[model samples]
Target: MHPPDAPGTEPCDWSWETAADPDEVHALLTACDAHQATASGTPAPRRRPETTRWLVESGSVHLLRHTTGPAGMFTLTARPPSGTDESVFPPAEHPLYLSRLAVAPAWLAGGALVGLRCVRQAVETAAGLGGDTLRAQVNPDLRDTCSLLDLLGFTPCGPASADETGRRHAHLHRPLTAPAADRRGD
Candidate 1:
């Protein structure tokens, strides 16, 4: 959780909790999907309960909220470098995958810093897990999201690929450095 009025630009009171309730998490995910569909005018593929369970079990499903209410959510998962990642990223660079990040339309009104907070959390979590790279697949249709990732130091790699949901996504990676807390500047 972010302390109230941290060194950032805004004075938002941001908090987060690891999603523990299955039904509650499901409803949150559903709301996020609906929000995305309304914004894009196209429904994003829904994840099954089993998939959500796997995420909750193997990683952390975070529910991000502000002073207003639930603003967004993101999932962070880390594992040893796999097939392509093993080759693309260094062998010692354990990859932390960021997935299912969605910010409600209303939250976007708070400005781009909201999205940056989510990414910062993901980066911090990866560094905590001894991960060397933070990896994610961005849907090409999401121009704003791609631009945000670009601004946050993520670099695109290779071409697009289809996931199990058949959605084409462009892979991106950001090499993780030391924790922000360890830095001198607040």
Candidate 2:
């Protein structure tokens, strides 16, 4: 991971681990929920403890830490194409799915730099894992996240759809093998 480009900021470090402490994950999620609620004026549903554990055990979690402390976290899991619906994830073919991406409210208030770095890391990791594409299902209401995905070259693959709980998600995908120029040189 690269250090913050802003002068006078502490250098940041990134760690990739297969398992993350559930409590830490929960804390981060709570912080994220609070931030979302404040920004959107609608409180996000708190994730269950079992869901948090599933995230830790389901894939590799990447954590970003600044000299101050944990700045952000994200998980990447490879999903087989077999069971995935073609409408949502066309040409899935073992794509790397990015999930649970959260930048602490403190970091988020500063700028998109932290979020950008995290998504860039996901792209790099997907390429390294021989993944053809990186995919994510984002809550449409989270405009910032959808915008970030757009800035990083992700394109909508399908229309927004509501889940069982009535939460809506927009499917997006970015081809990992695209040329640098095609990715806007990011």
Best by TM-score: 2
Kindly list the per-residue Cα lDDT of model 2 for residues 1-186, writing each as its tens digit.
233566665442445445468777778867987897678765476578777777677657777666665777787887522223456766756588887788888778777387888898889888999998898877778898889899999999878876666666677889888665777976
lDDT of 1 by residue, 54-132 (tens): 7766547887777766667788876421233434443334777888787755555445356677887888888888887
TM-score of each: 0.73, 0.80
Candidate 1: residue pairs that collide: none
- Stretches of candidate 1 off by over 4 Å are 1-12, 41-43, 57-59, 79-92, 109-112, 163-166, 178-186
CA-RMSD of model 1: 6.1
lDDT on C-alpha atoms for all candidate structures: 0.69, 0.74
* Poorly placed runs, candidate 2 (over 4 Å): 1-6, 12-19, 80-86, 178-186
On the 0 to 100 scale, the lDDT of residue 184 in model 1 is 58
Error of 1 at 143 (Å): 0.7
Q: How many residue pairs clash in each candidate?
A: 0, 0
Worst 10 residues of 2 by lDDT: 79-88
TM-score of 2: 0.80
